[model samples]
Target chain A: MDICDLGIVDYEDALCFQTDLWRKRVEKKVPDTLIMVEHEPVVTLGRVADESSMIDRELFEKKGISVVSTGRGGNITYHAPGQLVLYPIVDLAEKKRDITFYIDFLEKTAARALNRFGVPAGRDEKRRGVWAGGRKIAFIGIAVKRWVTFHGVAVNINNDTTPFSGMHPCGESDIRVTSAKEVLGRELDMSEVKRVFAERFVEDFGREYSSQFVVRSS
Target chain B: MGKMELRLPEISAGGEDVVITLWHAGEGDYVASGEDLVEVSTDKATFDIPAPCYGVLERMIKKPGEKAKTGEVIAEICTDDI
Candidate 1:
């Protein structure tokens, strides 16, 4: 597993990069990878997002937030510079070969990482994504091609959550969005958060990405 | 040449039941090996199942919007070149 931390990437550039990585992994050219990045403020719509889930077009334009249609499974979601996004390009054929299991793994990994930071995060069966209290602290929307997964979890670290107010998040307008900073009452080091997240992810799926195969970006 | 069975693969964990969402290859259509032939949703998300071998689609045991189980042959392909 190669962990690449692309600091402050544009949303469209990240999508193109993920697509290329997905194709490379599908062809067995590269080992399984986890691409981590924080996007410049933007809103992305998944395969099922409809007009009702989004806010007015002029509002988004005025705020300078770009709206993009993503290939992942879920509804509309927000992203910003302080959010930690992890796109794991994992080949499920060699692992569990099950989408449900893979998604469950991601949810577990994120929850465990949050637990280490003294934030109580868990999964809600009715609503996907990890939550702290009744407010959502993290979101997940993935797309798998040929059993290789991409477009993963987004964890709010210290970002301004005001932009999320512009639309219905994850198809629920009343859904509350929380962050690690809000829960901890202090801003955190993004790199340290990424470190803990990477460690927990390895702990969750270490069997597949063993010590000998794991790679980290400097 | 024999007929190749295109079964509803076990794409999700837990249950094998799924809903046939789409069929890209209809009966009598020539499909190449590894081409997407059908799609099914397992109460979560839709997944496209690819053809196992190059052949003409001979039959569709399961139609779109119908319920199916894992390992059930949804479609059959005559492996003989058409």
Candidate 2:
């Protein structure tokens, strides 16, 4: 598990980098790597998601936000500055190869990170993500192939929450969205958040396999 | 025993948060197990969230186009009576 924090990058560049990295890693072109990055505001649609999910596509385009369709499992979501996005291009076959378990582990790791920030985030038994005080604070969507994982979680830090109004987030209509900064009523240092996340990932992955996990920086 | 939290699953390479593009199942709908419940979008790609457990669609926490964090609940499924 190599952890590389790619501080704030454009959405397109990061996407290209992840896809290429995943392709290369699958073909033995790269080592196990965890790349972190933040992106400008953008909306992405998933494979099975319907176009009707987007309430106002034109409005988003007018604002210079791009909407892209992807191959992962889940609907649309937003990405912007102040949010920490992590892409773990690791060979899941080398790490037990259980997709469901892997997803659960991600949720647990994210919940733990939030807990470290005193947010008390935890997994909801009925749904699939971490929650705090009845509001969603994080989102996870990923794709796995030949037991390898691409695409990861997004933890809200200081990003704006207004754009979320354009669509039914994750296809649900009643839930209110929130962020770490909003929950804590203050801004968090992005660097510190990334550090805690990296440490938490190492701990979570190590505990899952009962071995010492080393994160290599790219 | 209480409301379950639905978190986002990794769909693409970058760590960028996605925008909610659609919701397949709406509130109060009877969703079976393994049904496509919701869809979330990211800059690199899009993905659909399947129902992990079966029950009635109870509540929706987030709407389309909204940014969902990695492990936050986007909706709730009520299985208490089912």
Best by lDDT: 1
lDDT of 1 by residue, A137-163 (tens): 888788766888888899988998877
The residue-by-residue lDDT of candidate 2 on A1-218, one tens digit each, is 67888788887788788888888897887888888899878887755467777888877989989988766766778889998887888887676644566677888998899899888789887776678888777777787654567888887878987788888777767777788888889898888999999999888887965542332221
Off by over 4 Å in 1: A207-218, B1-5, B16-30, B38-46, B56-80
Predicted structure 2, TM vs. truth: 0.69
Per-residue lDDT of model 2, residues B1-82, tens digit only = 6455567765433344767767888898888776678866543234557776878778878887688866677788887767
TM-score for chain A as predicted in candidate 1: 0.92
- CAPRI accuracy category, model 1: acceptable
Show where candidate 2 strays beyond 4 Å.
Answer: A211-218, B1-82
lDDT of model 2, residue A53: 73
